[model samples]
Structures are given as C-alpha cells and as structure tokens.
Target: MTSLPLVFDAPKRALPPRHLADLDAAGRRAAVAELGLPAYRADQLARHYFGRLTADVDTMTDLPAAARGELAALLPPLVTPVLEQSCDGGATRKTLWRAHDGTRAESVLMGYPDRATVCVSSQAGCGMACPFCATGQGGLQRNLSTAEIVEQVRQAAAAARDGALGEPARLSNVVFMGMGEPLANYPRVIAAVRRITEAVPDGLGISARGVTVSTVGLVPAIDRLADEGLPVTLAVSLHTPDDELRDTLVPVNNRWKVDEVLAAARRYAQATGRRVSIEYALIRDVNDQPWRADLLGTVLRREIGARLVHVNLIPLNPTPGSRWDASPRRVQDEFVRRVQAAGVACTVRDTRGREIAAACGQLAATGA
Candidate 1:
C-alpha cells in the first residue's frame, strides 16, 4: 500500500510583544488599562508619538518618572537601523533595519523636488518567489508587526523633517514596494495603513491618498481593501499581460489569473474613486515586447475602461547572479508608445538607489 504523505511541521518562534503603534486608539486605551495605567495615558502617549513625531519616552514628561520606565519597556524600539548607506549625494538613502528578533528588512527614502517618499517593507522577506526579484528569491521570513512597518516611515519622516535630505520636506508619500508582498501581510499592513492615515494626535496625519499599496494580485484581499474607505491608491503589479508568462513571473497567477485581478482592480476603483496603478517590470526579451504592452493596454482598457488606471513600467533591476536584465532604451520606449497608443497611460519608473544595493534583499546578503 502507498504510504500517506509525510507531515512535517515548521518550528515557530515566540511572537514579540505587541506595541502601542500596532493598536488603534481604542485598542491602545484597552492596552493601557490592562497595564494598570489610566485610560488617558494612552491618549498622552499617542499625542507624543503621533503629534510630536517623537518616541524617546524621555520626551514624554507628561508621564511620571516612576511609570515612564515601564511604559518605555512596553513600547521599546520596534525598528532599529543597523546601517544606513546613501547614494546620489545623500538624495537617496537605503536603510537596513533589524527588528526585535534580529530579522532584517530594508527601506528606501527618495527625495524629490515636490515630495519625499519612503518605500517600506511589509514582511521580513518575500514569498512571491518572482525569479527576477531579489527579495522574492529569499522567500518569506515572517510578517512584520504593524509597528515595525510604521516605524520605518516614522523614522524617515523624522529624517526628512530634520533636513536629512538636503532641505526639510515632510514625508509626502509612502509606498509598500520594498521586500515583501504587502497583501501577503494583509493584517499588519492594513493596521499600519490605519495608523498612517488617521488624523493626529493619533497618526502621522498624512492623507490616505498619499499612501500606495502594491499587491501581486491577491484578489480577495484587494476586494476587501476596497471596502476600507481609506481612498489610498492601489497599485497592481502586473508583470505581464498573458497568463502563460505571468504564471511563471507571478506564481499567484495560477490561482487568481489576469481577468480576476483586473476585475478586482475595477472593484477597488469603484469603491474608492481612486486611480488603480498597474506596475509592469519590463525585462529584456522577457516582458518588454511591443505586442505585450499593447495587449496589456487592451486588457486594462476593456476590463476597467477609463476608471482611472495608470501603468508604471519599471526596468527590471536584476539581482546579482540573476539572468534577467533591464530592457534596452529603444525597446522600453516602444513598449511605452504601444501602451499609450492603445489609450492607457504608461511611463517608466525613475530609477533610484542602484549604487547601494537598491534592491530589497541585496543589503541583507552581506550582513543584517
């Protein structure tokens, strides 16, 4: 008789203590009460962290000295930078962060004339397993807690305010396009989104519209996010239009397929009245052909039709030892021309941070 399939359980580590940043206002109040502190203490902490954008705890002079230590212990630093390397004359900085458990993640801060943006990771590593992506190659370590994710933005915001990027400009935008798939870490990412978009003395007070969350077509999660009413831009990473190639490029395609993803994008647009962004990574001789770009436009136009969908074409930044390479300039331009010819907006992404291992998984390779 054939033996049954073997069962092997993966070992699980003890999850870290939940931080106040991970909790909403009500939840924070509940946690403070559970910690034997008065409910108003939660509001005080929120004001210090969210309003003042400081979490040193020493600055929280409102709390008694005796109680400060306990509160600080409970709200210990969630994301500590191991090393910070910058290129472009410090205009672009990439940070390697060590979490409470020493699991490493990376975020990039880019300064622009109009606005500054921070690209934060949603998971410790990625599980998408896109052969061309550096982060995907590492596989997923674990989902980062909401606080860990938000703290990256918080620090970047603080840096921007402190003139880290030439002149002070607030962190005007945030993108979840770092190491891991944002949708894969849905719970924490959603919580982080709430903490980011809510009004201050509770959140960073950034407009919900400034936040962009990219997903590799997790349809159910996409649909659920539409109902959230936060009005954040939803970017769908559609590497290729045809299912056969996408099946290999994005393995999740086998389950949800292209039509389903576009349909979900439609749902998101309808719900939030926000434009849905299509992210296509143009790889040489792989996905950058003129015909594929035309097809992408056709599908997006037909499926979602003038419902505010734009495409951001990224030149594939192949990791070390990877076979993929960025598309040539001629091919890249032709692809953009074809997509725009078909009546859908498309543009190449501004390349940044290539000098200092700009790709997500690169920094952790040498050392965490």
Candidate 2:
C-alpha cells in the first residue's frame, strides 16, 4: 500500500511575496504608487512583462537606471529555472523551476505543426495522490501564487517566440496539466488563467478557448469555473468510469463519485458550450479494460452527451520503478474502438517528453 502524505488535506501554505502577475492594471498602479513610483510606470512595467515578455531588469532601457532597479525590486522574479531538458528533436521542452521558498515545479512546452502549447504547474506539488502520477506520489508541497503560475506561461511563451522549439511561433495554447490539480488551488489558478487569456499590455492575450484547466473531478470547482465566463476547456481526469476503480485511481472520487463528476462536467459544457475533455490514462491491467472503456463512453454520452464531451486516451507514462505501465497498443486500440463504437469521440493523446521527465514532479523528484 502507498503511504500518503499528511499534507494531503492540509490548508494551503502562505503565498510568496507579491509579483507583478498577481495584480491587474489597477492593482499594478496601486503597487507602483505604494513604491513611491509614478503611476504611469505601472503600464510600462506591464508592457515589459506581458507585451515584451522580458523579465530581465537590465533590458528595460526605457526606464531610468535607478527607477528600473526600484521597479524590479518591487516586481521580483517568481520563477528561477533550475533545469531544462528537451526531446523530440527540440520540439518538446520541459523546464524545472524553483520558487522563492525553494519549492520546485515543472512546465512543458510542445510545438506542433499548427499550435504551440505550454503545460504549466499551478502548485509546487500535488495533493491529488493519484497512485500512478509522479506529482501525486510526492504529495502537496504548497500552492503556487498566481504570479508563480503565470511566470511559467510567460517563460514558455518567450521560448516559443525565440524559436527555442524550432521556427519561431507564438504560444497558442496553455494547459494546467502539470505538477498539481489546478482546481485544488482554485483562486490562484483562476487568476493565472485570467492573466494568460486577457488581452496584451494587460495579460498574455491568449484566447480563453485555447487554454485548458484540468482537474481530478473537483466537482465544486468545476461548477464554479463554469460560471466564471471563461470558456477555457475543462478536462476531467477520469482514469476509470466506475466509482470503485476511480476511488482508488483518483482518491477525490471517494467524496464525489464518477456520476457526480460527469454531471458537473455536463453543467460546465452546457454553460460554456465547450466540449469537456475526459482524460483517461490507460494503465495496463488497471483502468484500460475494454468494459471500462465501454462504461466510460456510455456514461459520458449519457451524462454529458456526445457533442459536449471528448475522450483523450492517454497512454500511461509510468514513473521510475512504478508498478503502472502503459497498456499495449492492442489493448489501447480496442479501448479507443469501444469508446468510439458507443457513439463518442475518442483519440489517443500524442505523448511527449517522457524521456526527459516531462511529467510534472519528475524533474523536481530527480533533483531532490
């Protein structure tokens, strides 16, 4: 049996010092004013951070040298790169970032033919305690501040624009599918989502539809997010369709069963008119059975309907020495067929960055 960390249900730790991303336009002005700086400097700083995508204080030549130092001190850096590894001939890159308190998290940048996506962590470690997840095994370190979450996206966007992942491209998509259960750190994650999707000179300006926030069926959070008016996709990590198996795979299922989760997802889809993504990690002999796939398809179709739900069949990316392994291609194919046959849309996810410990918490674990 796995030993769960005591911090699983503990309250969130104190957030780190305020960073620029934590504030909106008005808040930025207030922050600058508090620092004895001109209010207009706030917009300049915002432009540098969000529009220019540069965090280096020395590069802000528009500001006076002394003012730049003072402004930089006010808006301190949130994430320091600890390690970065690339795979898929540089198309997929993973970065390990160390926060102010020394807690570490990771983010992944993947460049596809049409889109560049960055998967960012919302917490230093995860409390979900999903047995097969690297992040979950480590347990919760602490929730990341809104700025800490936003910094990951900023860094990834910079990398994408710099051609770090082949030809220069804009970061077109962001996914909260790294390190932690995003909805677990609800407020901060939502703020970060706003920061990512808001228009430029104010935020990253990425479209809300291009962003995805995944959770392990945090039902209340799902319902709350549906009302936020952000049409970002909601991905429920439903590794198994049955409550009994799901209870073991996603411990949160103990509180809200499979049906409750799918119901909440249905509400979200109906509210946003965006199809909910059902994430099913196909662990060999665990939750990859054909019958389970059939159940998954039936339940999703019955609850959320075919138009409002899509299944993303993930091949389990086993951690080092983990008991879990990916289901064979034969099994995986059959599972996809079963779900599709039930009149549901399903596709195998394009796995990436496994060789470089791209999965959340893997880099931090190895570093520790």
Q: Which candidate's TM-score is highest?
A: 2
Give the whole-model CA lDDT for all candidates, comma-separated: 0.86, 0.89
Candidate 2 lDDT over 55-132, as tens digits, reads 877899898888898888656877899788899999999988988878898999999999999999988888889999
Local accuracy of candidate 1 as per-residue lDDT tens digits, 1-368: 22211211112454457887888999888888887888888888888887778888888888998777767755777888999999888889999999878888999999999999999998888877888888888877888888999899889999999998989889989999998888877777889998998888678888888999999998888988887778899999999999999999998898789999999999899888899999999999999877898899999999987558999999877778889999999999999999999899988899988889897788877675
Query: How do the predictions measure up, each by TM-score?
Result: 0.95, 0.96
Candidate with maximal lDDT: 2
Q: Which stretches of candidate 2 lie over 4 Å from their true place?
A: 1-12
Backbone clashes in model 1, listed as residue pairs: none
Q: List the residue pairs that clash in candidate 2.
A: none
RMSD of each: 4.2, 3.5
